[model samples]
Target chain A: MNMLRRHWPWLLVLVILLAFPFLFYDWTKGRHSGFVLTLMSEIGVMAIFALSYNMLMGQAGLLSFGHAVLFGLGAYCAAHVVNMVKAGTIWLPTELIPLAGGLGGLFFGYVFGWLVTKQRATAFAMITMGLGELVSAAALMFMAFFGGEGGITIDRVMDTSLVGVRYTSPWQVYCLVLAWAFIAAALMRLQTQTALGKMANATRDNFERAQFVGYDPRMVRLMQFTLSGFFAGIGGGLYVLIYEIVTFDTVSAAKSANALLAVYIGGAGGFFGPILGTIVVVLLQSGVSLLSNAWLLYVGVLFIVMVMYAPGGLIGLIFMHLPIWRAGRMRELLLPYARAFPPALLVLLGFVFMVELASFTTIGAAQGKRFTIGGQLIDTTAPMPWVIAIAALVLGALWLRHEARGFRQRWDELMEGSKRAQATAAPKPQEAVA
Target chain B: MEVFVVSLLNGLVYGMLLFMLASGLTLILSMMGVLNFAHASAYMLGAYFAYTISQYIGFWPALIIAPVLCGLIGAGIEMWGLRRVHQNGHIAELLFTFGLALLIEKGVQMTWGLLPVPYRVPELLDFPLFKIYGTQFPAYRAFMLLISALMFGAIWLGLTRTRIGLVIQAALTHPDMASALGHNVPRIFTLVFAAGTALAGLAGVIGGNYQVTEPAMAFTMGPIVFVVVVFGGLGSLSGCFIASILMGLIQTFAVVFDVSLADLLAKFGFVVTSSTPFAEILTVTLPRIGALLPFLMMVLILVFRPRGLMGTRDT
Candidate 1:
């Protein structure tokens, strides 16, 4: 009963994942679901990548900018193995290629982590950046392993299977991604409960204190980084399996930045934060980019807002609501929250309108494209549109501030009340897991 | 000999330009413990601002106005944006600047369009200053030298002579002590950040035309400046200067030379072909691989001398 209670969420998640393709089958029929399948596989890949990154940034507190190097290296190694399979040289099943990638990741991680783990904080960040740049540059320069600018491309159809499953369809590739991602995520989660993981956290909290406890802080850091690399490598193997092509972009700073964005915005403090963040970022990348070119700007703005206002990220914000729920006062603040929501949204829309106007006037006009929303064409040269944009921006900002002030007051009151209630009643469980 | 001298001179000029950017960055990094990823954004802003101001009031006046304008923007960012996010710690500050960089990049692109602005050297200084053997060095290069040197002097004098400079020096070296002495450390941070950005702006005004005034100039110059700062060691101006010059010279002189490791190995009668380990990497010439040198140097330094060259404090 205890095991079932504890593990039910995992089972539920597994069921949902298994049902995902079937659920989208009616909507994404024929040639289109290839897109959906690819997108889903990408999510799985990014989730594993981001979760691994969160191990460093969130749990271990080691910020690495060159993490994608491990991922890319893994993919490249797997690509070689794939080619070897095609040539009938190595007799390993297709399912075992990712293990080869994991071994490659571990080897590189052990070598690189030795040098990097000697430093901490800002110095670590710089070293990782330098490392990232070196690898990325090398990936472009060397054609033997990296395959130069065209990157290493290979056929995945080797007719080799471990469990009688053909690896031809995108759906089959996605299932592989899903299985590996789940296994990798579960392993990483299990890592958090280990003594090494505890030591890593200890090192992050206070290096001196961890040392006082007779642990070499450097070794702890090295272990965490190397282990994180192992997971990231598995993610990369999945990447090669899904796309069948891995380029220098996989090892670029931008790719590393994607992990940083996902981890931070998802709430680096939570185990599942990066997982959630990965999904949202991929969704935004696919959905928002199709609609507008300013998707990056929006993501940047959102990231900054999250960093400034909610240091805990989306998960952190959700966690903050726990006290109110436990205190049974969730409904009391709903009305105030609703009142604050529209003005906040209006403020966002106003800024978007202004940004779109500026972007349209400069870039859109140059490209000879008209800015249209809901079939209404926006004339950038017109004074009325400009005035409307400005008014919406400035006025909405002012109104948001007013509503925000009221919201803050109510929020503080409710939070304070919850705290008092908790004090007066039985003491609530302390949040120690993170 | 002429190649050596010319390359050396070119290196010095390039180094000085890098110093203009790195100097401000080193200060912010040392004092705030924030890498200021947006530091390069300030340089780009300076160029764009100079380009706009130059269109209105010509190049000479634009140089002064653009830097001052950048300083104001830096001040605003520090006071409003960074200050608010300070409680969340250094990572938040870094992310804040990263976000600011994105916003400013988009803002610049929106305002100035995607293409490079036609920001040219003034007609007054457009002539060649010196003829090295057969090569003509532009008078604008000399002007860049003069401006950068003056900046170095001004910065030196200001820090040594002025009251605010002493406070900054104390904060740079002993931040906790400075803060405990009731010296309003936050205000000092604001001042340092603004001054650093102003220096970046100045670099942009002079160096922009030398390079090119474009939106992408930030990313190009950004990492190179960071390399200079790191190579020179953290929190040391003298070190920053030496490293900048060294990097500048290396990059320029590297372009002059066309030799590769493979060639050197073959000189010793070892004919390593494409099948040899790291053959592609070894066969790549110095000029082609010059861009990799700084990163290689950075890794080497961090590994052997983590404190950097001539650094007093460990980073």
Candidate 2:
């Protein structure tokens, strides 16, 4: 009971993971709901990828712009393995196919890390960017291996199996992905406690001190980079299995940007931050794409806010409130939240209106769709819509600013009162103790 | 011999264009220590702006107007966006620029749609300038070389003979010391950014017609430009020049050569069959890997010499 209490978070996560498929299966009825399963699988895969990225960014303090090379190589390797299996050259379980990608990642990481590890800081970033671009370009030009712009595809329905169980269901694939994700994440966590990982952190904090302590910073970086690449490759392998195709987009700079976004938004400092970030980002991407094309704009704005005001990230912000919450002073701030709601809603509604107007003018116009407002068909060809949007934007900004000031004042007053109450109550308690 | 001569001329022209884009980038990167990810986006904007202006006036007028517009945009971005994020540190600044790049790309697509624009070379430079062993060379390419050379001369003189140029040179080498010496460092940074962006704009104005103006143009050129900047070393104009020329020549010559590793191996009495895994790689010719060579060189240079050839600092 004490052990369970100590590790309740881990136990809770395990239960959640095991119960997810059953819940999903029940929700989807008897029909094979591949979309949700595939999305979940992608989320797990991306989580691993994002965590690998955090190893470099958070642990090693290396900011890479081209981390997709490992992932792409892993995908390509998996594709090749799938082809081989289909050709009856090898008999391996579908669950074990991702290992090929991991090996491929390891091989490339060893080779590339040897070169990239020589440079630190900005130089390292530029070198990785160059290598990433080179590989992606090569993927397009070299048709034999990369299959050109068309990419390479392989049939996943192969009869070759070690356990005599044909991999036909999406659930099986999801289970396999979950298993790998768990293993990869656990190993990565363990790595953080190891000697090399500690040295990597040391190098990140102060290279000169690490060198003085008899550890080569370059070697430490190389080891961490290789391991990160291995995990990234596993993610890529899962991607290929889910899609059954690998393309240049897999290794593009945009994909690297995606990984960066996930890590930053999720909170790079925390181990489980990437998982949170991956889930949020993937959901936003898949969900918001259906409603509007301006989701990226919102993400951009959010990222800027995080960088400027909340550098520790969403989790960090939540953690910052722990002292207040524990002291029971949080209740006093409820009125401020109530006062802030109307203006916040106005700002959100105005922002959404502007985004919708812009999207309507661009993508909607291209699709020949008519704009409608309150059941009245509004002509988008007129400038009235644009004028209204601009007005709303300006008005919304003004309201937001006013409300923000009011919110700050209310918060200060509440905090001051709470502190006074605590101080007065402390004297009474002390007197009683005497 | 004919192919070599043509390729050489073509390579030189392309090299000059690459230099135009890379020089400003090197200056900004070394002096500011911020890898502006939106540099290529500025180039793309220049092309689009030129196309729009050319529609109203002519290509010649648009050429001048486009770069000015780009400079103003750069100045605005620096003043409003970058300066605010500068307090956050290098990574935040980089991320901001990256986000800006993404916005620019999507914005361009939204504005212009997803098709290549009809950006043609000006009528004045439409004809052939010369014949290299019966093969005609475009006059536009000669014009590019002349303009690039003129810009190079201006930069050289500005850096060597002007007072502001000397201040910039000092700042490039020692940013902190220069700032401590009572120079308006922020103003200089903004000027450098605007100037660099203007150069990129000019490159786009001319090179867009030489290449193509499209939504994908930024992405296609962004990496190669970065490679040139890195391979040449940060803050070294001479290194940028040499690397640009080398890359241009390599790319041009690679496309002309069709030999493969397998073919070379056969000459050495090693006959490899097609069934092997290595065979796929071995059979790839030089031309096919042209796009990847610059990046390969960049990686190699970074590994062996992070400071680059003629770079003052490690980056």
Candidate 3:
């Protein structure tokens, strides 16, 4: 009962995730929005990808600029495997395709890890970047495996499912993705409790100390990298199933950047951080991108802001408020938060305004896109909108600065109170255990 | 012989331009321990800024102004952005710069549009400077060479001769002690960063017209510059210069050479065919694999010599 009570939130989240697509269901057509389903499936695949990335950045203290190499190669392997199954050269259940990808990832990860694990920190990052470039270049050059620029295509409905479900529809595919996501996430979570995971943490904090404790730091790194690759490969397998085609772009620096962005923006401090980050990143990519050409600009600014201010990420911010909530002083900061919201919103709107205006002036003009607000078109050539945007940005920034000071003061007070209460409520220590 | 001479000259011009950019990156990275990922973005900005400015005044004034503007922007980023993130650690600082690179790319696209700008060579330098056997070498290439050489000489002199240069060197090796000695390390950091970015901008001013000025120029140039830096080793300007030149020659000559591994192997009585296990490796021409060479060299250099050639310390 206690365990159930403690884990109820996870159950709630799962229910929410399952119910989300139905919100956009078309009853008349008896189907889900292809766009929404695909977007959600993308989120699922990317969530797994980001989590795998965290196994390096968050757990092992390794920053990779080319994680997509593992993901991409695994995808290529899976694509080839599917084609083979279709050709009757190989026999495998549809559900087991991701395992083949995992094996592929493990193979490459082991090979590449041998080269990269010799170095640590900045050198490792540089080497991985070079490796990423080399592989990407090879992907374009070698037409046999990577299928040149046209890429490799496969049919997902191979009719070889162990569970006897032909994965023809997006719904079926999404369900498979969900099941796999859960399995991968749970396995990854359990792995963190293992000795290797703890040792990986130890090395991350202090490699020399870890070495003193009779562990090879390089070995620890290699193991972590290989395991991470396995999970990332599974994500790549799902990608092949959904998209039906895998291209050189899958292995590109930009794809690696996607995983990095998701991990960083979501916060690398906690287990659920990358998942949170993946959702936000995917939404911004799919949703916000449809609304504006300057979506990349917004994502960039957000990333910078998070790095500068909230390096702990969204989860970290939430965790910071935990003590106050426990102390029942969360209500005290409501007023300050309310005061800060308007200015923050104003600043965001103003920034977006300027970006849109600038974008419309160049890219928009070429595309014949006029800037609009609430069904009313705003002239790009006009000085009025520019002045308003500038005014809002400048004024809101100043206002936010003022409100931020108040919020900080209130926060510190509440946090100090929480600490004091917890200290006083605890039993005092005996002098000599008499 | 004509191809050899022309390729050498072209490589020299390209290498010098790379040095102009990579030197600044080398200094900033070594001194600050912050890899300024936006270094190439500054180069792109310099190109776009020069293009716009040239349209109004002329290329000469644009050359003088664009780099200065980039320098000022670099100073602002260091003071406002980098200084604030310095307390967070190197990873945070790196992420900050990475985000800045993305933002700058988007910003450039928004301002300049998606198309390449017509940032042409001035009429004075448009004509042929000399004939190489049968082909005429453009005077603009000669101008690029002259400017890069002058800048290189100036940088070498400044670093070895000037008092500020001595101070910078002291700080680069021992920042905390330099701080304790009351030399204002933060200001020096800002100065170094600005100077480095300005150097990149100068390269952009020359290189943009030499190649093409577009949004994608930064992405294309960014990785190759990094390859040069890594191959040369971190914190070594001379190494950077050498690596740049070597890479420049390799890339230029690789395009000229049509020899494949298969052809070399055939001389030793080894045959590569369609049925071979690694036929792609044997049959691919040097020119076909030109893009892979620099990265291959970087990876090999990193694997064999982590300190890089002439590098005084480990990265």
TM-score of chain B of each: 0.98, 0.98, 0.98
Better of 2 and 3 by DockQ: 3
DockQ of 2: 0.52
Displacement of residue B141 (Cα, Å) in model 2 is: 1.9
Candidate 3 structure quality by residue, lDDT tens digits, B161-230 = 9999988998878889999998999999999999999999999999999999999999999989888888
Model 3 TM-score (B-chain only): 0.98
List of clashing residue pairs for candidate 2: none
Model 3: pairs clashing at backbone N, Cα or C within 3 Å: none
Query: What is candidate 1's lDDT per residue for A54-104, written digit by digit as tens?
Result: 888988888888899888998888889999989988887888788778877
The DockQ assigned to candidate 3 is 0.88
Arranged by DockQ, best first:
3, 1, 2
After TM-score superposition, the amount by which residue A281's alpha carbon in candidate 2 deviates from its true location, in angstroms, is 1.8
What TM-score, to 2 decimals, does candidate 3 have? 0.98
Judging by DockQ, tell me the better candidate of 1 and 2.
Answer: 1
Find the candidate with the highest TM-score and give its number. 3
**Model 1 Cα lDDT, one tens digit per residue, B1-315:** 999988888899999999999999999988988889899999999988898898999998998999999999999999999999999999999988888887788788888888999999989999988899988999999889999999999999888899999999999989999999999999999999999999999999998899988878887787788788888888799999999999998899889899999999999999979799878878988988788789889888887887889777777
List of clashing residue pairs for candidate 1? none
Local distance difference test, candidate 3: 0.92
Q: Residue A126 error for model 3, in Å?
A: 0.5
Q: Could you give the candidate ranking by TM-score, starting with the highest?
A: 3, 1, 2
